[model samples]
Target: MVERVTLITGAAAGIGVELARVFSSNGHRLALVDRRGDRLTTLASEIVAAGGTAPILICCDLEHPEACDDIAAALAVEGVEVEFVVNNAGFGLFGYATELDRAEQLGILAVNIVALTDLSLRFSESMIRHRGGILNLGSLAGFLPGPGMAVYYASKAYVLSFSEALRQELAPLGVRVTALCPGSVSSEFQARAGIEPGLEHEILNVSASDVAYAGYRGLMQNKRVVLPGLGIKIVPLLLRLFPRGFILAAIGRIQLRKRR
Candidate 1:
């Protein structure tokens, strides 16, 4: 069991919960951050019941500009320097860019792109000194342009690019950065992203625990990018072999939902 302190965002449910379970089971102390106060408390309690150190519950909306400040302060007061930061607090709005409300689209950028980037940069400096790693939650959307989920795809692209660049910049300093890109995971994410249930009925989704374990192994191995599923690992390479227009059209059709 490792003793390093790990801070995970969006840790109340879905992939976040599984990630917490993985780290906690390995004996790593956690600082779980999420907007759901009740859920956060429940998650922390579950960890304790399972014999892990009581997780520090941080219930705050990442959309709020002051959220990171609060996190930094809370950890400082505890004198806890986080060795691994899972910037997993992100959500997607599945729709055309302009078709979605402007406010909603911007909100996706705020939480998915802005908050993740800010927190990683803020934590990376300390991580360099503490000698640990940072894991950013990216997606298959990052590699392709989604005609329907335009804004969400673009935001993930930003995460992938930012994390990869940071990985190179921080590597020489002994700090590892890895981007975890999983395909069609069985979680709240698809429902919350407005993906149609019938469309999802066709996908054989990977369990959140499987994705979490894959991410943990990749980060420990110091991999720059980890695509969890076999399908996902070949996607980027196969995509490059196709024309951009063809790729975009194919994905756009797949993203379309059947009428009920």
Candidate 2:
């Protein structure tokens, strides 16, 4: 019989790394995917050192259109079945949408939207068979518009929407889907997005470990959405109190201010 495993994309760093640790520590065998083979190797060693199962590492970039299919093939060849999926590989470019390189912006959609959606749907069949779960890493930015990182925010909105709908559709089949929407996480994401650590980031920021813990706990509990931190949990309620135009302009200014 194929071994059942938790497959995590972007497992090389940030919350991805923490998620791997949490799941592995809980005795879940992992199939870790990332473009960085070296980092994946180091992580796999660390997991094994800590008395966890050695993870199956797949060093493939999710930006490729056939990436999800490739992942499934790789897992099959390893004689493993994906019982849980974590769609954590995503990036953002910080700038006005029009001013940023169009190709780069589209790459954002490629990974954040296309790849995430594809992987979720692809392994969902196996998850249903195994009565397993999926944990998608969304963002607090998904709740509102992002002016500087337009494509990134839009992509996360799609993640939030898609995860919610997928959750409902998969629940009856014994497949749990939970979107982990965190606020500013202290990770490589901000630096990659070219977002400077501002007051808002400081106020809202939570450690990747905390977010990972919340995600793991929530998924096991079959929660539809897991928003880590008090600050993150308050964001949606606060958004409800604001006018759309005001919220839009305010978020735009904040994002623009984070430039450089």
Candidate 3:
């Protein structure tokens, strides 16, 4: 039997790295992609040292438009047939929209929205042909308005909606799709987002390992959406049930408190 290859973006650390560990432990060959080449190389070495196969480390920034094509071409050259693709490369920004730099906002969109969506489409086409799987990392913030982190929240919302629709469209082709929605997670996300560290501790936070495990399980089950934390599981449903105005007001209040 041919060894299965799983391509995971942002695989140098956080949830992405945990997902790589999970797949590697299960005997799948990995193609770990991340912008942090040094970290990716260290992780690959550790995996190999631990007796699991070391992954192919692709250290290219996915935020660029040409990244998807470049990765696809590189994989072809390496003779790695991707049986699974996890679009997990993302970051968050926190601040009032007006206070944020336009270029920074656009950069966030390029990585969190454009890259993810384009990669999913490009990889899904191949997956459909091979009857493989795709897992997208969304966020609990996707369910409702996030006042300070507007663009990041909106990007995640797109991910959730896109993953669900794609799952439906690809069902007949045996190409499974899953969207993993996680709330506050113990990672460098808070620092990267410029979120107050104190605020993170106040919320129900799950470990990256927990999020990765749940995401992998849900992906294997072909679930359309998977919320990692129990407290966050009801957020999507509640957002759908409540009025949008009410949700916005609540989020605004929370943001105001955080800014204080």
Candidate 4:
């Protein structure tokens, strides 16, 4: 018998960890994936301690070309099918696009774009068969042009576009797709992106647990996009009200501050 489970990537920390907890608490079997094996084991132990089923952990980095395939094979060996997918594994670098290492910039696309797309399409058949759902973690950055973190922002934009289109195509097949677009989330992401928490992050920041709950509820309700915080919800509207050039210039200035 194939056990159906929710597959959550980047499950070692931040929103992914909280998402795993939220889903598990709601009685979903989970398959947690992260590059950090130690963290995965700790999370598995935590889940077990909390009375949830111990999740199947696949500690593989999504940056590799074969990572998605490896995850699928590992799950197959465990006799589990992915009933839900959360494409939550992604990162960014803060700098001028031309200044960052060429390979490292490509690594951003590898995990955030290629791996995300690969996993979504890879599990579509199983999700459709089970009337399942996908919850993609997009960012408020997706709606605008980012200057400091060019590749990362572009990848998120792809996530937003692809998820919306996928939602339309899958709705007829009883599958749901939702993009969770939060503003400045307070997480390790900022430190890794070389971003300092400033007035912007302070004004728009949402907690990881709150974001996870919102994402879970939104996915269950089949919302095409979920913007968690009240502050974040207004951003898309604000973007529409502003001129592109003005928005671009504003974003560039904000990003430039990180360099100092």
Candidate 5:
């Protein structure tokens, strides 16, 4: 029997990698994408070694809008029909909005916002035709206003809103759309964002496996939003109850302390 395949972006590491593992274990083939070719190759090899099917590695920089089209074409050539898509590739940026470089900020927006949306639109059409599933990685930051990490927060906000809307639009067509919103996860994200490792303990931190597990379950159940931890699950409610000015002030204090 031909194996069903899932396409997962940012699959070289972090939650993306973990999600791939979960899907592969459940008997799905994978088309894993990441900008880091060497890492992607190594991850595929590791999965194969661990008794899972090796994933097809596509090492294209997704920041380029055309990359999604290229990926779609490449998958067609491989004769792989994506039964599921996990749009998990993203990065974080830290520093005051005024102090950050224009190029750097734009890069964050490109990966976190533009690339995610492009891939969702491109894949959602295919999934809808096939009646498949889509799980987009959002962040807890999406629920509340962020102060210092302004662009990253804004990008996640877009993700949350976009995923929710698309979920409703696609539900009648039998395409499952889930927004996986995880809190501070144990990943290289903090290092990339220039956040010190020890500071992670200060917040509610969950494992990549934990987040991936919740995401997988939610996708299968066709949940609209999947916030992994109990603490994070309550955050949306709290954010909604708090005054906007108060929320912003609280976020500002947290960001300021993190910078110190």
Candidate 6:
């Protein structure tokens, strides 16, 4: 049985919940964090019914600037020692930067860039001492500029950049940092990102569980970066081969559909 704790942000649903399940299966004790306490409780119950340990639920809106500090304080108070921190909680806006609500775009940066960065730094200090690992969720969108989801794409680009730098810094200390870049997954992300109800991304969508499993494997293998789906893995290469103008135009048209 794994005695080390793995704390996962956004553990109430989608890839976060899937991450929780995957980590739990490996016998890691989980501290599941999300804004939705009730949903987390429900998920905990299900996991318990399946003979897993009841996860400790941490309910906090990660949008608040101090959220990561607050969670760290709470864990300290609980005497919880985390072996892994999965920064998986994030959302995007599906519109032109000028057209989308300014607050919404900032909120995307808040959770995606700020909170994830804060948690990774704060937790990695301890992880380094213990020779543990961190897994950050990036996106295929991070490899290219996104016209419709400008802030979201930029935020993930930061994640990809940050994770790589941090990984190198932590490498000598025996602390692993893995960035999981996945293409679109069939999840609440589309609705939450304000994608159109009629928009279809079936061809690009991968399963959350698949991505979660790949993330888990990558983290265990001490891989620096993991592209979970075939489409996601091919994207960066394609980006390099295509002319910037052509790629941007194609992306613009695809993203424009979400705005309609």
* Residue range 145-185, candidate 1, lDDT tens digits: 98888888999999999999999999999989999988777
**Residue 206 lDDT in candidate 6:** 76
Q: How many backbone clashes does candidate 2 have?
A: 0
Clashes of 6: 0
Go through the candidates in order and give the clash count of each.
0, 0, 0, 0, 0, 0
Query: For candidate 1, what is the lDDT?
Result: 0.86
Expressed as tens digits, the lDDT of each residue in 103-175 for candidate 6 is 9889999999999988998877678767889999998888888998899999999999999999999899998
Q: Which candidate gets the maximum lDDT versus the true structure?
A: 4
Candidate that would win on TM-score = 4
- Candidate 6, which segments miss by more than 4 Å at Cα? 1-3, 197-200
| CA shift of 94, model 4, Å | 0.3
What is the lDDT ranking, best to worst? 4, 2, 6, 1, 5, 3
lDDT of candidate 3 over 153-173, digit per residue (tens): 999999999899989998999
RMSD of 3: 1.7
C-alpha lDDT (0 to 100) for residue 28 of candidate 3: 77
Superposed by TM-score, candidate 1 places the C-alpha of residue 201 at a distance from the truth, in angstroms, of: 7.0
Off by over 4 Å in 4: none
Error of 4 at 232 (Å): 0.6
- For each candidate, C-alpha RMSD in Å? 2.3, 0.9, 1.7, 0.8, 1.8, 2.0
Query: At residue 253, what lDDT does model 3 achieve?
Result: 85
Flag regions of model 3 displaced more than 4 Å. Answer: 1-3, 197-201
- Candidate 4 lDDT tens digits, 116-224: 8999999999999999999999999899999989999999999999999999999999999999988888888888877788899889999999999999999999999
Looking at model 3, residue 19 earns an lDDT score of: 94
* Candidate 5 per-residue C-alpha lDDT over 69-112 given as tens digits, one digit per residue, 9 for 90 to 100: 88888888787777798999998788898998888888888888
Candidate 2 off by > 4 Å: none
Give Cα distance to truth, residue 221, candidate 4, Å: 0.4
For each candidate in turn, the TM-score is 0.94, 0.98, 0.94, 0.99, 0.94, 0.95
Worst 10 residues of 5 by lDDT: 195-204
